[model samples]
Target: MERWKINLIVLWLGQFMVMSGMTMIIPFLPLYIQEMGIHDPHEVAVWAGLIFAANFVSSFIFQPIWGGLADRFGRKVMLLRSGFGMAFVMMFMGMAATPLHLLLLRLANGVISGFMPAAVALVSANTPRERMGFAMGTLQSGSVAGTILGPLFGGVLAEWVGFRPIFYITGGLLFAASVLAAFLVKEKFDIEQAKTRPKMSVFSGFRELIRIRQLPALYSVTFLIQFSILSSMPLIPLFVQELHGSGQLLAFYAGLVGSVTGFSNMIASPLLGRLGDRLGSQRILAIALIGTGLAFIPQAFVTNIWQLLASRFLLGVFMGGLLPSVQTLIRQYTPSGMESRAYSFNTSALALGNMLGPVIGGAVSGLIGIRGIFMTAAVLLLLNALWVRLSLFPRNQVQKTGS
Candidate 1:
């Protein structure tokens, strides 16, 4: 059996558990805040946003630190560290008696959060160069599948067992995942040589990376795409209610829309990744951006749930393509021997998007009606398509490195 294949399968499982633990709390986090004695509805909403954003905010600060460590030591260590660290924090979260305690735990979770990106870096470093797209796409599919199942399972589990128990359950899954990874994943490392090598600080690495012409734009695309997609999430339930009015199944309907995208994304990611492997990630990325833009148009005008579902489904397929393509580009251009650092920096861009997307979505909702968010996202995607075409296509020059 090929080592890369082994890494893929084990990391796939690890990533699935990691993604599930990350998202499983979203549906009930506000409820947990209320359970901790917050009664005012507005206060609950504010605290929910703060707790939710807290992880990403810390992650954005800490990614480069772990990335540098991964480059010097080995990615697997970083992966195990995050997996175990997050597991402990999640279990501790179950004991929180106040919203502040919960918020602090979440912040700690973010500080320890690099399991997925570390997995990506490990897989990217190990895979055959020609297969980076397929590996990343395939790995991404597992995470997407976990994300799809997380909220659905969490909702059901919350109803069946209550919120605090859900935390313990998720923590157990993460711990199991870390233990499995400790046995199943392996990396070839030279600690003595790694120690001898002149190590660049994370900020220095970022500075060197920005000097690459294509990287900043790619990073911007990472930020913009994430911003555009997430900008709509907070509003989805409200939009559903506006369309159908209040009912018993209203939350279910909103969740259906949320889950459907991950389902489609999980299904399409690997297939589209293979397509990019053959057709070139640049070509696939442009098409995905345009397709995503077109997909959003119908969503903005949709008068019914089915229409929204169909549009979101298509958007998911394109989204599945967009992200892997970006990763492929990052892989293509990364400086030799610096793969971990490059992915870490890129992960920061993504973390920033996760933090800011909701804020932008919320602000947009305040100004324009719910439909405007979709249109705004669509426009950003379309413009990005043009930017990609103009930037990468004309020169066909993706600054090459042995990486």
Candidate 2:
């Protein structure tokens, strides 16, 4: 296989490990807190929200810093840093003795948790432009598969060996990704560019991105894509519970509801990627945005597990296309020497969505009901679709940048 292809595969698995490790603790987060001596349900909920948000808070602040480093040093170095750093931090999280300790460790985790986007940057930097959509699509499948399965795996492993062990296992997998990346991933790096690149402060780089007409829109697409999808995440289990009532099998069914979309997403990603390559990424992205917006409405009104599963599966088909198109658009618009920086900033935008999506979703559910959040998510995605139409396809062309 070609070197770029090799890097794509390595980074695909790396992204999977990164996502899987990050998500594996979710199934039992509150339980783990209880183990740490927090018995009050409301206090557990508060701590859980705080600890989860801590990761994104620190990650949002640090992603641009890492991006600049990736451009200056090499994308691989950043990948290894995130991979190994996450491994150590996840292990530390497993060893937390108190909610404060877990919260602090989760904060530390955000500082090191750019591995997935870093891997995306590495593959984006290395892949040929024509194949960018397909490569990203394929790569996304891995992470999506991991995300879909992570909760299921977490539940099973928690039942079998307990929650702390899940963290250790997740940490081991990330460490293994570091080893694989160190040994197998290769970049046709420009040492001269690294040495000669002007010192661009992160603030100036943000300003510079704003100077580019399409970049901010592309960044918004990145943010909205994450925001729309994650807005449904914190409420899925509750929705499932509402559909079927609480039982011994509630967790299992809830996980199944979550995993099914990932199944369709993993299947549709590469196909939509190739479709985007042939049909124009912006056009397909528009289709996906609207399609996903529509998909959420059916999910909002589902009366049974089958109906919800079908709605989510449909949602997954369009969801598969959104990010690859966004990444392709990013590749088209970014300048030659700043691939890592743009992706890193884009990752920051994604982190911001993650930081806020669940909070907003939680608020919607609290005020309305379980199904109401899905309606809110649908409206948000529809608005985002309009933004894409206005911002990206203004003249029916993604004005080719001077790369």
Best by lDDT: 1
- Over 235-297, each residue of candidate 2 has an lDDT whose tens digit, in order, gives 788889988898788987887887787898899889999898888888888899889889989
lDDT accuracy of residue 322 in candidate 1: 78
User: Candidate 2: minimum summed lDDT over ten consecutive residues — where?
Assistant: 394-403
lDDT (10s digit) by residue, model 1, range 166-268: 8899999899989989998988766677778788988888998888777777887888877887888888989998877897889879888877888888988
State each model's CA lDDT, in order.
0.86, 0.85
Task: For candidate 1, list the clashing residue pairs, or say none.
Answer: none
User: Which parts of model 1 are misplaced by more than 4 Å?
Assistant: 394-403
- What candidate 2 gets wrong by more than 4 Å, as runs, is 246-249, 394-403
lDDT score, candidate 2, position 3: 90
